[model samples]
Target: MAPQIVGLAFGHFALRMNPILLLGALTGAQTVTAAMAAIQERSGSPVAVLGYTPAYPIANILLTTWGTIVVAVIAS
Candidate 1:
């Protein structure tokens, strides 16, 4: 996944910058969510999951929207 994300970054460098940042953030969110789930499973507590659960979706949406705005601005 990391490698693929890196490939995407390089692939899009000529196109624009916002997409690379957006993809990187989305990948990071997935990685953290997975790690938190693993920790929660081992710890047998919801605390680990709670730490990131609420912020994940919100960040995803906000970052995606921000990326779109950036692209639009850059294009114009």
Candidate 2:
């Protein structure tokens, strides 16, 4: 819900920019591959993947590290 709200807000703001790329980044940040595929299908372009690539890996690493830290702290 929260990410969707943010995505919608960004989507509105991204109107003047590259909507495809912004959607890509948003989906990537949330790790939603289905959304990325839908966006590609709707836009008939794979340009959004450019934004997804970087955000996905970074988010994955950060979330994993943070989750591990939280678990360790709680366990200890």
Candidate 3:
């Protein structure tokens, strides 16, 4: 929650990104599909998905790779 709040603020104020799209991207990075869905539904626009799509796959790949590294480290 804290990270999400900070990210939203940073994206909105510092980066000057659209709040709705930033929220979508944040949700995507976190792999929170439900939040993304709610955002789209509330905004009545699929535009947020533009932010989500790229972030989602990248985040998934990075997280999976990191998890594998962590497991290898633990096993070693």
Q: For candidate 2, what is the TM-score?
A: 0.79
- Give per-residue CA lDDT, model 3, range 10-34, as digits (tens): 9999999987789889999999999
Whole-model lDDT values for every prediction:
0.59, 0.86, 0.92
Q: In model 2, which regions exceed 4 Å deviation?
A: 10-16
User: Considering lDDT, which of the candidate structures 1 and 3 is the better prediction for this target?
Assistant: 3
When summed lDDT is taken over every stretch of 10 residues in candidate 1, the lowest stretch is 19-28
TM-score of every prediction relative to native: 0.48, 0.79, 0.90
Best by TM-score: 3
User: Model 3 off-target regions past 4 Å?
Assistant: none
Cα lDDT of model 1 by residue, 1-76, tens digit: 7765675566477655444244434444554566565655666665544435554787688779999999999999
Cα lDDT of candidate 2 equals 0.86
lDDT of 3 at 12: 91
Candidate 2 residue-wise lDDT, 1-76, digit = tens: 8876777686767655477888888889888899999999999999989978998999899899999999999999
Clashes of 2: 0
In model 2, pairs of residues that clash are: none
